[model samples]
Target chain A: MSVSLDPVNIADKLSLIDELWTQRKIAGLNDYEIKLAKLKGEFVWHTHPETDELFVVVSGRLTIRLREGDVVLGPGELYVVPRGVEHCPVAEEETAVMLVEPVGTLNTGDTGGPMTRAAEPL
Target chain B: MSVSLDPVNIADKLSLIDELWTQRKIAGLNDYEIKLAKLKGEFVWHTHPETDELFVVVSGRLTIRLREGDVVLGPGELYVVPRGVEHCPVAEEETAVMLVEPVGTLNTGDTGGPMTRAAEPL
Candidate 1:
């Protein structure tokens, strides 16, 4: 099996990303994948029917809009959107985030639309 | 299923920990767990035969010693120790780190010792 010995610099990899709402794969942990993304504006409401999604804010601010309420996160903060929970992400300003989820999970979840983009290696 | 709506502030959760080399479970992603730990000394060499382990340095420096070479990481840097790889972690100074691995994975891996501690929720 091939193994990566090189360390991944989260900030450095994020610096290479220019598009908002696009995720770049950084590493893999078993059946899951770790990704980095730059996000801004509002994203479509979605839900992963089979897996939970983790969002860790790296810079700026991110607001996860749930039907119940809104969860705001800053740098060094993280929140997990439970499986089958409908939620939309909104960023008033540019935000950098790290995401952890199953390898084949989609960004738009069951509500997939035009915002869906496959995460590629950085 | 209970879903945590509150955002977990990594720095805040880390501030509650006082013991070095002890892991505190911060969150859960599917069957895997997200943990936070503080380190300042050498850890025992061990290997997980069934899973990969991810180490993300939140502050200070971390060195992962492998048979091939040592992978050093600073803040905002991360490294993954592939399955069945013998490795040891060392920190010269106080360092805060985030670890992601399978739920039942132990701190000491296959080589259990006095240094091994069960990760408790924060």
Candidate 2:
């Protein structure tokens, strides 16, 4: 069966996520986790050993940092962070994003730190 | 690193998908494919025994038909068709959709037909 949601009209959902840090699970599979998150400020550093993570910019600007370089992603741009790569995602302003990761994956991965934003949806 | 795409401001991307029949794979994992598609008219009757397919309308409306009942999904609506369920998606007017399904999936599944839409991107 088919149903759809216009990504352009998800204000309410975004507002909901603003007060929370969880990546709301929209739909996903064993290979990836598709989630929507509201983010701002500097996020923790982490890596995933099981799967590559992708971020698609929908609104606002998102900055991704690696040891070598940093990418500034705007709306309509996408970035792929291969598995086992260390990186950090930060936003100077409020930004909304869609995250795709594998199931049973950890947001923090092997770097178990206090800043690891690892938790299920609230 | 982090990137995000706001679901509410995806008009340009939707327009790009117009006049197209393929599910434009945006991002994915080993188990699923996330795609954006522009659709009108009746799609094939098919089933996926390996995964539950989800349809989210980003704009316009969508309809899903099952052997028993059909569901009419609006812009904010979502529907998940369980695996092994025979179903068809039909649209009478221009519609945009976001699809979540497993990778290497057959849109028509076991009973392939001319109506089955299978192809890589153009």
Candidate 3:
């Protein structure tokens, strides 16, 4: 199978679901992976011990709950969750976001319950 | 100097310029930096030898020209330039884009002409 070299349109390629958040890999670099997620409801509080995670809101609003305070992100807005910083992302309505993290990063960092899943490449 | 931990709005934070492409740093992580750029016209041919570069178009269109082919990206679209690959980015009109790369990575890779600039932190 020949791999086609094409630019990934995150909004058009998002794997949207109703109940839980869905993640689809847009591209993989040397050590990093770019993934797009459609999110609703709340995700588990987790922390990446090894690397920082970047969340860029593509559309809609996403609130990242932290111990210190809550960070709300809108479209074109981004926040970096420092390594080992516990964060739970919550969205009142449907939101689309692009995530940048190192390869092999677990979706649910420390807590891997029912929501933990291996990302699927788009 | 107190650094505020707030989300950065790429669309709102973009430092638009009339001439050559303009880039401004949005945030910095452990090993990577997020930058927002407003571009129009052609950029010099360059290559990053050590790390791959990511380009996520926030709005408008951007075309990355390579020796073999060209990749055209639209809003919400992304493309990764592999390490050591020579590429030239050109935008016919004003375009807003977000870039991800390792810290200390030069804007102009192998070739540093007039456009070689040290990124200014936002």
Please report the candidate that would top TM-score against the real structure. 1
Per-model chain A TM:
0.96, 0.79, 0.90
lDDT of 2 by residue, B5-69 (tens): 22223455566664544677666544456677887888878878777777767667888888877
Which candidate ranks first by lDDT, i.e. highest? 1
Displacement of residue B75 (Cα, Å) in model 1 is 0.2
TM-score of chain B of 3: 0.90
What residue pairs clash in candidate 3, if any at all? none
- Using all chains and alpha carbons, the TM-scores for the candidates as numbered come to 0.97, 0.75, 0.91
Q: Which stretches of candidate 3 lie above 4 Å from their native place? A: A1-5, A15-19, B1-5, B15-19
lDDT, each prediction: 0.93, 0.66, 0.82
The 10-residue segment with the lowest total lDDT in model 3 chain A? A14-23
After TM-score superposition, the amount by which residue B42's alpha carbon in candidate 1 deviates from its true location, in angstroms, is 0.5
- The local lDDT score (0 to 100) that residue B114 gets in candidate 1 is 95
The sequence of per-residue lDDT tens digits that candidate 2 reaches over residues A13-104 is 56666443357766544344457787788877877776777676667888888766787887766676767678888888888876767665
lDDT for model 3: 0.82
Docking class of 2: incorrect
Candidate 1 off by > 4 Å:
A1-3, B1-3
